[model samples]
Target: PRIIVRAIRTAGKLAVDKVKELSVKIDNKSPEEQRDLLQKCAVTAMSSKLIHQQKGHFSKMVVDAVLSLDAPLLPLDMIGIKKVSGGALEDSFLVAGVAFKKTFSYAGFEMQPKSYDDCKIALLNIELELKAERDNAEVRVDNVKEYQKVVDAEWQILYEKLATLHASGANVVLSKLPIGDVATQYFADRDMFCAGRVPEEDLRRTQRA
Candidate 1:
């Protein structure tokens, strides 16, 4: 649970930072512009990858988590590939697969994911407001809530996909975008959403787009 909390905390911090960041960006733009920008950002966030060190940090954290849980199954030094589980993993290899079984399942869902830590940073975090840039006949700007809902749905899908991969057994090297829920947890405590720490901007951004 300590590892879980840490993962959540890490994700929380990162998401908070992202929200704060994007909010400022939104503030700089008009409502229509801000909404558009958020859409772009969401798409970008989902489709991108993270830097090496950042990915590495999350990777290491995953390794520690697996080791912590499966310690009894393998010796400390024998934890690497070709060692145990045929480098398969003693637990959900943060560096390996999503290993849904590897990590604790929270929020009533399971997703396997490789560390693929970059997913959080690299992706744009965009919403699906323009299912093709709004209907031409509809000149009126879409409501913020509309875009937010779309974005939220997309983010949720993204999070689930990532987590499923991790939980399944990709415990070596992750490549796909992280599941949004796991991504959310990757930033902070699971309680973050419940406690209202999840940035309002992120939530708003998610729902409309």
Candidate 2:
């Protein structure tokens, strides 16, 4: 048993060495020759019975997704794959821009804007909600009138932030943090596109685009 184990380990080492030798040979080749070799290897590997039969189709989908970026060097991390179990592989397609799963905080907002030709976007790292300076502050509200005034003051501050965003000629607002209902309603009233609570990485990619 010990002899068999030793022999198997030796064989594994030899296999790894052989792969390293082949990689060095490939690296020493011209760019054109290396590309040709890579293409041939990919084709041969895809032809193996153990592999998925539709790998070529999936490969094309990946290639198309990367090419859609239109950059000389690909930012592959920006490519997002959304898999649905019931769909055929052929039904898969690539989307040009960043795709994110988010919903409008306000119910009445339109999913998309009517015009995008002159759309200027604003990206906000801060939340549209108002933050209290003191978490535990004692407010002496004598009556309903006083309480109403306090609530209105908070709303006014949130409104100002929303107004500032709109005043900046921002047709689309993307926030990395949550946007309050007041802010969302304000944006909806102006027919502006607003998305809140977006992932930080996605926001960075959108800024780059």
Using TM-score as the measure, the top candidate is 2
Q: What is the TM-score of candidate 2?
A: 0.66
Q: State the weakest 10-residue window (summed lDDT) of model 2.
A: 103-112
Residue-level lDDT tens digits of model 1 in 102-188? 322235232333234423222233321113334564433379888788778766776665455445443222112222344445433
Stretches > 4 Å off in candidate 1: 1-141, 176-209
Whole-model lDDT values for every prediction: 0.41, 0.75
Instruction: Give the root-mean-square deviation of each candidate in angstroms.
Output: 25.5, 6.2
TM-score of each: 0.20, 0.66
Q: Candidate 1: deviation at residue 111, Å? A: 20
- Per-residue lDDT tens digits for candidate 2, residues 130-159, read 666586887889999998999899888787
